[model samples]
Target: MINGRDPRIDFFRGLALIFIFWDHVPGNPFAQLTVRNYGFSDAAEIFVFLAGYAAVLAYGRIALRDGFVVACVRILRRAWVLYVVHIFLLTLLMGIVFVANNHVETRDMIQEMGLSYFVRNPQQALADELLLRFKPNLTDPLPLYILLLLALPLILPWMLRRTEYVVGLSVALYLMVPLFGWNLSAYEGGVWYFNPVAWQLLFVLGGACAIRGQRPSAPQPRPLKQQPLFIVCATYVVISGLITLSWKWPGLHEMLIPKAISDLLYPISKTDLSPARLLHFLALAYCAAKLLPTGQAWLNNWPAQQTCRMGRYSLEVFCLSVLLAPLADMANALAGDTWPMQVFTALLGLGLMMLMASGLELNKRLGTPGRVVAV
Candidate 1:
C-alpha cells in the first residue's frame, strides 16, 4: 500500500479502473462481468465516489492544517493540471481515432466517439473544449472531476464545520436536477452524460465519509453490525441482486416481480442518479465495508498490492486507459468478436495496465536511491 493511504481504497479504485476499461470497449463480452451487470450503479459511481473520498483525505487535511486559502490554491492547482492533461488527452484521442478511421472502413470512429463536432465546427468546439463544455464519450468523466475539484474550495470549509449542511446542499442540488431539468450544457447542444449536478451527491458523500474517518478500511463500532440499518442494507443488496439477475432471465424476472414495482423501477435513470441506483450503491458499499474490515491482511498480498499501486497512480493509469480503449476496440474488430477474443482482449488490456503501474512503482523506487545518495 502507498504510505499513509488506505489499501482498500486503492484496491477498489484500481479494480474500478479495470472495469471502466472493459466497459468502454463495447461488445467486448467481458463487459457483462463488470459491476453494472449485477447492480444499478457501475464503475463510474465507484470512480467518482473514491475520487471524492481521496480528495478529502488529501486536500481536507491540508485545509485543516494549513489555512483554507492554501488548501484552495492547492486544489485549484491540481484542477489546472487535470485540465491540461484532459486537453492533451483529447487531442491525442482525436488523432488516434482519425488515423484509425482512415485505415479501417468501420463505422466512423469520429462520429461514434462524438468528436465530429470538432471537425464540423472547429472554432466553437475548440472554444467549448477550453471552457470544459465539449466532452466526447469516454472524455466526460475527467471534466466532471475537474469541475468538482474546482468547486471543492467553496464547500471544504463548510464541510469541515457543518458536514450535514454540505451534504444537504449536495442532495438538494441533486434532487433539483430531475425536478427542474437542470444540467450544464455541452457543445453541439446536449447535456453532459454524467450530469455533475446529480453526480456531486456521491462525491460529497464520499468526502463526508472521509472527513468522519469512516472509510472502508477504518475500524467501526461493533454495534454497527447489530443495527437495524445493517439488516436493511443487506436485504436491499440481496433484493437488488435478484432484480439485476432478472434482466438476464426475463421469464424468471416476470415471475418474481409485481407489475407495479417493476413499472416504478423501470428505466433506472443513471444520468440522474435515481433513488434506486443511489440506494443500491450505498447498500453495496455498506456490505463491502462490513466484509472487508480495516487492515485486512489479504489486501496486502501480491495481486491486491499491485491493484493498490495502480490506484495510487490513478490519474496516469486512467488517462492511459482512455488512450488505450480505441486501440482495444480496433483489436476487437480485427480479431473477430468471439468469446475467446473478448476474453483475450480484456486480460491483455488489464495486464498491460498492471504492467504500467508496476513500471511507475519501480521508477519511484529506483529514483529514491539517487535522491538519498544526493542527500
Candidate 2:
C-alpha cells in the first residue's frame, strides 16, 4: 500500500524536520542558520510550501486509487493523529514544568488550558512553556499543523472534483488577504501561529498543479525548456527582487503601489500567508529543489538509502524531536553563555537526535523496538 512513495518528498520532509529541530533548540550553534531565527529567510514558509506540495502529491495518488471520499477520510485520520500527538506533548510539557518546580501554581496551569492566559500576557516566559502558546514557543507548530490538517479535506475535494472552482476560490481568497486581515484572536482555544484557513489556498493550489500534470487540460506539450520548474524559478527571482527593492528604496514607499503590492513586502502580523513571505519561501524552495539531486539510483540502493528511510518515517522523527526540544533547551540554558559549553551541549543534543533517528530507522526495518527514538 505504501509502495509508491516519492523519495524526493520524503527526503525534503526529512530535511525540513532537521531544520526544525535545529531551529527549535533554544540556543544552538546552528540556530542562527536555521530558518526560524533568520529574519529574511525563515523555514516556516519553506515548511508550509513543501507541505502544500507533498499534500498534493500524496492526495493525487489517493484520489486516483481510492477516490475523493477515501482521500478525505485519510486526510482527516492523519489530522486526528496530529491532534493526539499535540495533546500528548502538552501533557508531557506540563509534567516537565510541574516536576521542575513542584510549587508551580494550579492557577497558572488552569490558565494555560484556556484562553485567558494568552490574553493576559503575550510574551510571558512562563506562559510560553506552560500554556504552549503559539510562536512564543517553538512547540507551537504542531497545533498549527493540526489546524491546517482540519481544512485539508474541505479544500482537497474541490481541488480533485472541480478544479476551476478551486482556482477562482483560491484567487478570491488570495486577493481578500489584502482587503481584510484574518481574525486570528477569534480562534477558540488559542490561535494557530500559522493559520491554515488562509494558507489552505496555497496547499490546494499545489494540489491543482499536480493534478494538472497527471491529467492535462489539453494534450499540448511545451518544450523541456519551458517547464514549470523554470517558470517557478523565474517568478521567484522577480518577486524576491521586488521585495528587496521595496525594502531598500524609501522613496518607493510613497508611490501609488496597490494595497496588495504594499501588503506583499510588509506583511501584517499574526497572518501566516502573506504574499511576500509566500514568494520568499517559493524562491528558497526553487533553489533547494534545483540543488537537491533527483537521481533515483542511490534512493533504490537499499543499504545506501538511509536518507530515504529518515524521510519515510518523518512523522515519528518530528514527534521525537519536539518532545526532546525542551530538554535540549534546558541543557543549553544550564550551560549558560559559555561558548565552549554551549557548543558542546548543542553537539551533544544533535548527536542524540541523530542516534535516535538512526535507531528508529533500524527498528522500523527490523520490525522491533529496541530503544525509544527521541528525535
Question: Whose TM-score is greatest here?
Answer: 1
- The lDDT of model 1 is 0.86
Full-model lDDT for every candidate: 0.86, 0.60
Give the alpha carbon lDDT tens digit for every residue of 251-307 in model 2: 784464567766655654435566656655656655655555556765676433554
Clashing pairs in 1: none
Candidate 1 off by > 4 Å: 1-4, 214-225, 369-375
- RMSD (Cα, Å) for all candidates, in order, is 3.1, 7.2
lDDT of 1 by residue, 1-375 (tens): 112556788999998998899899868777888999888888988999999999988887788788899999999999999999999999999988888777656567788888889999989999999998888779888999999999999998898888899999999999898789888888767888888999999999988877776423533466765877888998998888879978888899999999999899977888778889999998888788777766958886888888898898899899989988887777767665567877788788888899999999878987885455323
lDDT of 1 at 352: 87
Each prediction's number of clashing residue pairs:
0, 0
